[model samples]
Target chain A: MKILDIYARLKRDMNYIEKELEKSIYSDYTIMRETSAHLLKAGGKRIRPVFVLLAGQFGNYQLDQIKHVAVPMELIHMASLVHDDVIDDADTRRGQLTVKSKWDNRIAMYTGDYIFAKALGVVTQLPNPWIHQIMSKAIMEMSIGEMEQIRFFFHTGQTIRNYLLRIKRKTALLIAISCQLGAIAANAPKSVSQKLFLFGYNVGMAFQIRDDVLDLCGTEQQIGKPPGSDIKQGNITLPMLLALQEESLREPLLQEIARIQAVDGQTDVSAFIRMIRGSNGIVKAEAMAARYIEKAIVALKDLPDLQAKKDLIRIAHFVGNRSY
Target chain B: MKILDIYARLKRDMNYIEKELEKSIYSDYTIMRETSAHLLKAGGKRIRPVFVLLAGQFGNYQLDQIKHVAVPMELIHMASLVHDDVIDDADTRRGQLTVKSKWDNRIAMYTGDYIFAKALGVVTQLPNPWIHQIMSKAIMEMSIGEMEQIRFFFHTGQTIRNYLLRIKRKTALLIAISCQLGAIAANAPKSVSQKLFLFGYNVGMAFQIRDDVLDLCGTEQQIGKPPGSDIKQGNITLPMLLALQEESLREPLLQEIARIQAVDGQTDVSAFIRMIRGSNGIVKAEAMAARYIEKAIVALKDLPDLQAKKDLIRIAHFVGNRSY
Candidate 1:
């Protein structure tokens, strides 16, 4: 099933979350208000909140009860995006000017911090200490993951182990928590919450692998920027790691990579993308991602067969297949 | 009593906090660990923790119970300072190379974020939902204050009211929370905590006013950095605002301010400093600071006649009179 079809199942709750997400980011500060509105306008798939609501459905499924958790989870993601743009030094995200590009780095940093504080402020509205603990740990891991990315930037010695650990911290953990927090907040059974966490974790892993793969294969129109923008930013992704392991593709790719690393100007990254795509790296990465998707599907089998379960299964499939 | 003498009263608790503060910043990531260590070695006065401890003393005064809350308060301060250095584009702080100078802005930003996350992670050990709420609001206000500072930078149209509001949010709010959180964490009565918050709020106002004053009158040795460092970074402080109001000093100072705003390089700020000091601006600012100290003393009157109250009074006096 398509992602939209999956989203269609929870349209009411999703729309409410979308509204709450917009309202939550409104600040009295003019720049903050404008920047946050700019981000909200440049919308995402609202996948995290969708996962949150879907997971909550397994329990009491009260929109009012789960929204405080869901909205802030997405806001946390939004805040990270603002900071990430500054780190990537990117000019556009989803065909819109990033906060850092439109303003300055200082403003971007403040905006990110402001949004993060807003997330914390909103989440604290709920009286659950465990939710705070979980969210705090996820945020901490994400920051550390960002730092690790910075440390490993343009470094050619990155192992697949390093890439996996970084992706888990930077990307997967937040998604997993979104599911776990939703379930726990709605008073889902511990067994159900644990399974949702596992399912979300596996889906998160696959989701990131698919994202990395698309960075190599997708077009600028499809991905909202150049296909190899990650490569341009010197982010060593899964396909790149796999490509480097191949003897035939390795040296020529390394030469191009070295040239790109050495210069300040935009080196043509399309050539590097082509070289990686030509290898078995793409196939191997896809197979790995598919395995993760399989694990996610397997984790869902033990849950009570609710309509939300079928939607979640479809969502997991869609994460593996999404182009953008 | 002098500030050091007040500090001497809590030397044992202060020492323990100092060590915990050090231990808390340590991370598995090498860059995070080293950068955090660099910040720790910069050696703040550790005044936030002292206030926290002193306030906690009014309650049950268990060193073990309050240490977690106290340590994170200082960590939040340290994290803001790191980010503030980037905002200020400052190379040196307290005669040492700032994190941005030692590494780069991206590293500095990440380090600040890492420290903030660590603060949250550390504080999550406490079960109090109210502490989380208080700390979250303090952090949110601090970010808004930073954005306001950014918004008002180099704009000479800023009023004393704006300056007061900014300083209260950016500086005083966290200090107030440090005291309030300490009392609350130790299970102090609501009345005692409210009074302590008021006391901290006034003292913090006085503390920041004194800091702004010292930025003008203190020697380089006393202030660590040069006087007018704030002006150099386009920060319009209380003394500068007062100096700008003087008819005799206005035109020349405006001309110099215009020149500084126009050029990117170092403009000689000594002339503006001299002009402000030569006027009654310093005197007026000091009087204002003194008024805040008086207010802080008044807030303490309702509290019990305890050693902590006396120490807090002395601390307020020291803030009003401090050279740096």
Candidate 2:
């Protein structure tokens, strides 16, 4: 199944989730409402919510029942993006101006806080402390992931383990929770929910690796920002990490990084991008992402085969193959 | 019934709370643990926790039962302060370097987020969904309050009602919840809990009003920073609001504000301070704070009179009279 086919199957539910996301972000304050709407309108793939709805389909598929989990999951993602933009000091995301660029960092911070509060406010209505426990842990991990990212910025000593762990907390955990919670909310069997979690976790890991690769390889139009922004911002992702392993490239890369960090202006990133692209780093990262996709598919094999399960397989492959 | 006497009575419980607070902030990550410990060491009066304990006394007070609520309340307060410093671009708070100043805004934002997550993580361990409900609502109100404050900055058209509402969310709502949640956690009577909430609400209002007044009249030694920092940062407090009512002072104050807003330097605030101090604004603001304290005392009149109740009355009066 193609990504389009899976999306087609989930279109009605996705529309409902979209509306619920919009409804959940309503604030009495105008700037908050506008800031939140601005980010929401920028549009994401809704991958987390999509995973949530798909996982819920394994048992007791009810859009209304799972939306409380789904909408907030997406809203949490949106809230993080707003704050992430503030941290990145990026002017645009997905080709639109960020909240920080449009207004200011203070406005962006408050908007993020407000959206997070609304997410919490809506989630607590579930009447289940277990769900709260899961979400609180996800949020905690996500915050830790952000801290790790900030501390690791421009640091040369980072390893593959560091990269995996950071992305695990920043991306994989939330996606895993989105799937697991949806299954749990639908009263799916415990084993099934656990399997869904692993499946989503592996898929999420692959998803982020792919995103990091695209950050280097994809163009401005494709990735929605300038190519090589991660390196420009001193974010050492998988592609850069792989490139650093080459003995010939290491010294030059280190020199380039030092020069880039020393200056405030736009230092040319094209030379580094050209060097990395010429190396086998992209191939190695892609292979690793493919391995994660395989693991994700393997995890879902134990669950009873259904259309949703098929779509989960398709999503894993799509994540592995997605260009941007 | 002095502040020191109240501290004497609550000292044992406060120590336990202090330990629990330290334990709750422990993280596997070094920066998180260090950043959080830095803020925790730069202690406030632990007023919110004290309120929680004092209000818990009205019911079947168990230190273990209420300590969970009390510690997280303080942690949430700490998290907000960290983020607030980033927003204010403040170099120091409470006589110590702020988290932002110590590290950077990125670290400060992450530390605040990590602390907030820890607070939420601790709170979710409580099984009662109602407690989650109350805490969630308080968090929502606090977030909205922060947004209102951001929007209201440098806003000349704000009213007394706007000022009151802003402080209600920023300060009083959390205090009120600290009291109300304490009563609820101890399984207090509903009417008693309601009364405690009102008492806390009024006390918090008066507390913030007095704090705003002190911001104008206090010396650098008293406020732990220079006087008029609020107006310096575009925060128009109660005294300034009242001073704006005087027809003659209004134009000069507006001109000073515009000038302060324009150039970024150490503008002499002494002239405006002298003018406001010479006016009736301080006296009027004090009267308003006194009324709130009176209402706070009145809220508890029908409850079973006990030492805790009397201590609460003393706290309200202390808040009304506190110079810092």
Model 2 root mean square deviation, Cα atoms: 1.6
Number of backbone-clashing residue pairs for each candidate, in the order shown: 0, 0
TM-score of 2: 0.97
- Candidate 1 chain A, poorest ten consecutive residues by summed lDDT: A262-271
Q: Candidate 2 residues A147-211, lDDT tens each?
A: 88877878888999999999999999999999899998888998999999999899889999999
**Candidate 2 residue-wise lDDT, B1-324, digit = tens:** 398999998999999999999999887888888888898889999999999999999899999989878998998899889989999899989899998999899888878777776776677666666777788778777877887887887787899999999999999999999999889888899899999999999999998988888888998888898888887877888888898899989998888777877764258888878888987899999999999999999999998988999999998889999986
lDDT of 1 by residue, B101-132 (tens): 99988888878877777787677677777887
Candidate 2 wrongly placed segments (more than 4 Å): none
Over 4 Å off, model 1: none
What is the lDDT, from 0 to 100, of the residue A290 in candidate 2?
A: 95
